[model samples]
Target: MKILDKYLLKTFLITFTTVFVILFFIFILQTVWLFISELAGKDLDLILVIKFLLFSMPRIIPLVLPLSVLLASIMTFGNLAENYEFAAMKSSGISLQRAMRILIIFICVLSLVAFWFANSVIPYAEYKFINFRKNIAQAKPAMAIAEGQFSDVGFYNIKVNKKSGENGNILTGVTIHEKPNNYGENKTVIKAKDGKLISSEKSSILKLELNNGYYYQDVTPKKYEDRSKLPFVKSAFKKHVINIDLSELNKVDTDQESVASTNGMLNVSELRYTLDSLNKNIDNEILSFSENINQRVGITRTMRAVKPEQKKKPLPNNLLSLFKKNKEKLELIKTASSNITSTIYSIDTTQKDLKEKQRDINKHYLALYEKFVIAFACFLMFFIGAPLGAIIRKGGLGLPIVFAVLIFITFHFINTFGKRLSQEGGMTPFMGAWMSSFILSPLAILLTYRATNDNGLINFDAITTPIYNLFQKISKRFLPSQNPQ
Candidate 1:
């Protein structure tokens, strides 16, 4: 039994390592592709790019590990079953459950490690990745400008129709919209045939030198009758220089505390604290809103003062007198109605804001639950893959990869769909987080039972036989007289 355990552990580890590396590489490549636009044309050093990729790896691990476990378990168990090793173990009176005991322990440990990685390591990585990207953006101010798009640099919005030159410093068909200061009546617009950017590490300003440009500035007329004239100034300049302040971009802050409150940057404890704080804030907001509404509407539980046994007044005989008596009451009713309408509108706005805040809270809860749920997925995948492999008896990557991908896709889809539902308030955070595992666990158990009993995993005959018969009947009914012959 000890020999068997050692052999099984050895085989599982080898497969797990191989699958993990392959999946990690594939996912990292995918990550690179996803962010290529951000990293490309930035003239970043090789080291910075590598650092970006490295920082991204921790986030990928949580996604990759479970799929690797699934693939490894399937391939390992399928090879054993295909080679008749399971039969030999059974002949020696070893039950399937007993055979899996050691491997199960190993998987549980892996799950715990996964949890620790998600809770501790990934948060730090997330913080680093975010700040690293920010640093990259700030490293080269020119990188922020893409060809044929509006780029915001300080107070100006610039658009370039074409870019050329070795360093991409030369811009053609340049358009710059300069925002106005407090005293300026309208924005200053500049269009140039060509422009060149000049900046240096020592300087705290970016200078754009424009050639053959036209500047237009609108002027507001002081008199109403003169407004139709729409006074403005348009001037053509042989050369013009625009200065942009870059002092803020030169500094990169590495303090993690700056982003500590973000959902992805916090550990479980921090997440819980943030969630509690948000809920308390929401409660206070609701209480304050209610109080405001009560004050505005003059709501009170106290009874109105009773008149001291006053005699009933006789009705007014004249129409003018009656009209005068009711006019004051009608105006009071109109004023009360308007106040009620305004209060209702205010309440509606408050409810919308409260709902948005609640959704944000749900998002935090989902993130909190995801840390644990993703870790537990490793164990669940192993259970599912091992039994499935044993039942299929197909070794190697051919069939196992297909099954692993299909199962993983199904799991991922359910998880993503549930998360979206939670975000939209269609589902509770807990239910959304665990929905995939809840669905797959029962299938894992069923597969295990069928595999252990040596019964067909899918009962293909039961499903296919009826379909075949139905096809045959359809064919006979559709055939011509030649079918009788």
Candidate 2:
């Protein structure tokens, strides 16, 4: 290797490593803050907490690695420019691109490693993290229910005023709200003065025993007037036991909604397989629904067997006239109206269901595209940072840090916004995942082209030099200059 190449590599490596560690630590703190509810006051073991954080730490690499590369590149090149090292290299017939050759190769290699980590390592960590939380919640159901606030655990939102036990199994002033079910309302509520959570190591159920509690369930009436009275079924019990399935202990602990979306748990090939199956299932469902609807409104055997009258007559102006009695005509109209309404309702409901399935499919596509995005982000950030550093011509922690933060925040914000919009069916997953990259590519190209040509970020000297001359002329015109009086 040439001396210049080795020097450049060493500088960049040292900067990248330092920036990566600092940024990783900052992001890890943010992660801990996000999941503090699950970790704090849960009576969890120290090793368990450490394992939880370790599993979650890998997910931060995609964010941290890219930002670190960006900051490092900017700082390294900016520092060289600021210190006139680039000036020395340029005089030695070394162009900016020549100096960056080794770093470019290094970045390409890093991108590949990033892609592998996102595909293999991150997914495994997500799976482990999710399941680990689930196991913890199951073993200690109290973790799922925090004191003072209602914590969502499967079908119930449970709140406890106080918990006093080694494992926080003994509760006081318990309140439970059953989520909406067949009743279509969260009307079932249970309150107890004292409660105890009982669970066995071998069992997959948490038995909550409530003492001196009242169970109240709303009973909706068919008549609107009767509903206004708000009738309810209330019963007082000396001791009541509610069995909760451990499997449904709110599988989400870290993310917005991980359990409902298993895309995080699957690798590339697995996601593709799942997507294919989901597509097929949706197709079959639509075809089945269409056939069923056809049958519902299809012409029956009786209609096919009907014979035409011997003498053809003009149809009546009013179809109701064909019926002998007015009452019979009214009955016919009512039946037809009800049937039409029901058919319309069925179609509407099916359309909504199909839309939901499509959104899920989009989420899977987004996840698949995300692995590629993180890999490409390395390349993207490097290009932007390297050229920007050369162009800015200022270095160190202050200016480089400011620039890195603004650029990264823009990239991250756009990426996050696009993902959310894509998940909501605002755009295709492909466009959503690559939107930020596309938006930033132009800046990188512009910077790189200008930097290669030895152009400044802006023609600042042209602007400033003219202003300086104008001010000098104005000063001479306004006041007499006395050299030696």
Candidate 3:
């Protein structure tokens, strides 16, 4: 290895390490702030907290590492250019491309490492993080309930106006909505003036003792017309005690859902497998629906034993004439109308459901492609930053940081927008995943070519001189700058 390569690599690595650590810490703080509701007042031990942070840290690498590389590359190269080292190298017959050769090799290796990390480590961390979240409330049964907002613990949605006592066991004006199913329909509500929570870690039950409360259970009639009555069974109690199973709380589902969705929790291989099943599920559902619709319409059964082609003349405009009786004709019309309404409803419902399933398919494809996106992003950022630094010729934390931040923000915004659009079926998953890279890649190439040939970001003389001459001629033609000069 040449001395120049060694020095450049060392300088760049040092900057990269510093930037990575700082940015990672900043992002970690943001993570902690985001989940503060879960952590604060939970009486969680340090070890659990550390585990939570550790599990969350890996997921931030994709965001942090790219920004780190961009900033570090800019800073290192900018400093060298500012110090005239790059100029000296250029004078010594070392082109910008030659100077970047060692770093290019390093970036290639980093990109591969990034791909491996995204496929293996990030997915593992995501899986573990989801599990940790599911189990977090179990650490403290009381922790499951927040003071102001409704908290889902077990089958009940619990809210407390205020909680007092050392362990926040004493609740004032508590309201509980008990959901009998996972889809969040609540048939039972209990309100208490005061309550106390009693729990034991070893036991899977949390006991709630309430005072001066009312229990209201809504009842629905089987007849649709009677539904508006909204009959509910209500009872007042001087004191009541409810036992909630902690094990059931562990079964609680979130948007990511029981860790079952695994949208971001699967490696590329597993994603492909899951995606295949999802596609098959959608196809089978459509097929089954079609068969059901055909049967409902009675198309599969011949309406008449004789074929319609046997008719010598056209049927009467009054098709009901064949029925012979007005009552029979009216009944047939009513039945047909009802069937049409029902079929329309079925088609609309199925159409909406199919759209959601298609979105799910898009999400899986996005997840699969994201692993590769992270890898490519490393190369993208490096090419952009290295050449940009050479062009700007500014060093330290000032201009380089500004340039890196603006570029990274643009990349991040486009990436987020593309993913959202893709999820909504606005674009293909492949396009959404690579959109930011595609937009910025040409800039990378342009900057590299310019820097290699000792060209500035723009040929100001070529542009300004033409504009200046045009303005001078315009002035000479319109209003001569006079004899004042």
- Give the candidate number with the greatest TM-score: 3
Which stretches of model 1 miss by more than 4 angstroms? 145-203, 206-244, 253-257, 300-345, 461-485
| Weakest lDDT window of 10 consecutive positions for candidate 3 | 249-258
Off by over 4 Å in 2: 146-261, 298-319, 460-485
lDDT of each: 0.85, 0.87, 0.88
Q: Write the per-residue lDDT of candidate 3 for residues 256-368, one digit (tens) a residue.
A: 33566677989999999999999999999998999889889976645445578876688689778789888999989888877786787678879999999999999999999
Residue pairs with colliding backbones in model 3 are: none
Weakest ten-residue segment in model 2 by summed lDDT: 249-258
Please give, for residues 286-318, the per-residue lDDT of candidate 2 as tens digits: 988987776777655565566666336755798
Please write out the lDDT profile of model 1 over residues 1-485, one tens digit for every residue.
59999999999999999999988999999999987756776677798898899889999987899999999999999999999999999999998898899999999999899889889999999988977876665667766555687776778879888877766778999998886666443357899999998878789888999999999887766443344466778999999998888898767543322443578888999999999999999999998887777777765433123343543665467534544567776876677666776676677778998999999899999989999997799989989999999999988989999999999999999999999999889999999999999999999999889988988777889999999999999998997547554
Candidates 1 and 3 compared: the better one by TM-score is 3
Residue pairs with backbone atoms closer than 3 Å in model 2 (clashes):
none
Candidates sorted on lDDT, descending: 3, 2, 1
The top-ranked prediction according to lDDT is 3
* Model 1, global lDDT: 0.85
